[model samples]
Target: MSQQENPSSLRLQILTCHLAASSRNMASEKEAALAAVPSDSRTIFDKIINKEIPAKVVFEDDKVLALRDIAPQAPTHILLIPKVRDGLTGISKAEKKHCEILGRLLYTAKLVAKQEGLDDGFRLVINDGPNGCQSVYHLHIHLIGGRQMNWPPG
Candidate 1:
């Protein structure tokens, strides 16, 4: 039968197509656009690394750099990042080769927490995408402390 004559079948087909597309879009919603881009592409982190923009640098090495976040969520808030992007746009884009840098970033967060006298405790956050509220594409660990952290962080 012709589609127009079969109104119910037409409605079903439209609903099915819409549902399929909706599912696919939802599946990809968690994906970051940066994942498709070259990881070496410069981000604002490069400016912080290059010292073109002044940041309260707290720690630095040949591999990693830690600086106090300008918009501090806690009394002691620092951002630990790799000196080299190395195709690490975010943790979601991390590959096996990124293990070393990822480890360094986390370890640096711990060491800096001690230095900041957050012996009580601290929070390390790696925001991945829009849902994580990751404004910058570069991979960095946020170390926040000097106060009690609430559970179920929004």
Candidate 2:
């Protein structure tokens, strides 16, 4: 008998097709949203910095702010970002003027990692452009720890 002749098989096929379509639609929506925002435009991180959006801030100084990552990759995942953009959309866009803020971001990451009690070790990540999996345009450092990290991180 043909696969469609079986009611259970036909139901499973329909469900699979629906899931595939949903996935495609979701992907398309994400692409559209990304395209809608210019690379130099203010991002969600800007909102967080301006206090327009609430975040679980862990550390804050005149130059930088550290907050817990909403989508934590580890038990202790935090994001360190400069309080001012200064045309730093990402590390790839960094200029000589950005050196000071860049160093401050990393140093704050270390301080935050220690505050989180990551005595064993931790990882600091700076995803760049679209190919680098940077969903946000604002420059930020990711501090991930509280678990054993594997090599060649994703």
Candidate number of the best lDDT: 2
In model 2, which range of ten residues has the least summed lDDT? 29-38
Residue lDDT tens for model 2, 1-154: 8764654564454344334443343454244333432268888889999999999999999999999987777899899999999899889999999999998998888888888899899999997654454567788898999999987553
Off by over 4 Å in 2: 1-38
Over 33-116, each residue of candidate 1 has an lDDT whose tens digit, in order, gives 323232357877899899888888999999999998876778988999999987788899999999998888888888888889
* TM-score quality measure for candidate 1: 0.74
- Return the clash pairs for model 2, or none: none
Model 2 residue 73 lDDT score: 70
